[model samples]
Target: MIICELKNNQRTDALVSELVDIWEDSVRATHSFLTHADIETIKLYVPHAIKAVPHLFVARENTGSIHGFLGISGQKIEMLFIATQYRGHGLGKKLIQETMSLYPITDVVVNEQNQQAIGFYEHMGFEVYDRSAIDEHGGTFPILFMRKP
Candidate 1:
């Protein structure tokens, strides 16, 4: 697989749509705590979020099929999603490692109910430093704020 940062002009609508599909698939696979309605509601903002993130990196196969992506803003990882079939194959880790080498990434927020994600972040050397009863969107899902320190 190859990982590369996307240039501004490369973030076309078609790419955003593809990323959104990956995001939704990943969310459905890992975020079982979310109801269908919750997913639908959150999906509305994903495209915009993908477009607005300061740095976007994609992991793709040699054949040029994207399998995962990471989004960073400031010193935080705003998003990371791997296609369901690509999970556990080190693509996510590669993305994080590559981005950390280029950016001073220190923080990431994960859903408390998503134990798999929490464990993954912990394995990646992040520790929970704070917690919130609601998500950023004011949803009921708890949030765990982690930092690499």
Candidate 2:
């Protein structure tokens, strides 16, 4: 079972490796990205930035080890990662349900290449507002701007 927690001061208390492991697993499972290095970069800087924006939900195993997470920057989803082993049990959808109630509008950016995520977001009630030519370094990387209000 997945337990959802509101992001707060104790988020970084989760081990960095477990967080990275979640990303590593998810990216591989979804065929979205190439490696865990993106998460490695986050581990280096996200903790310090957490104080400025402290809302992050870290998923822990029943044994209390971090396995996946979803972070919110206001109503916008900043990060969502689920360890491969723990996915398909509804953690991702649960996180969205638990988080979206906190805001009036919720928006998420899904990389164009990630077909699985695109379908998942659509299933979750987010609608694609517009497609862009990669503004904000978006051109080379297509981003589906999804909004649910």
For all candidates in order, the CA lDDT equals: 0.96, 0.68
For 1-149, candidate 1 gives per-residue lDDT tens digits of 88999977899999999999999999999999999999999999999999899899999888989999999999999999999999998889999999999999999999999999999999999999999999998988899999999
Worst 10 residues of 2 by lDDT: 45-54
Residue 49, candidate 1: how far off, in angstroms? 0.3
Instruction: List residue ranges in candidate 1 displaced over 4 A.
Output: none
Q: Which 10-residue window in model 1 sums to the lowest lDDT?
A: 1-10
Candidate 2, residues 1-149: lDDT per residue as tens digits?
Answer: 45556445454455544565566667678754534665465456654544344466666667777667777776677678888877777888877786666644378888877888888889998988977656344335567789885
Error of 1 at 12 (Å): 0.8
TM-score of each: 0.98, 0.76
Against the true structure, candidate 1 reaches a TM-score of 0.98
Q: How accurate is candidate 1 locally (lDDT)?
A: 0.96
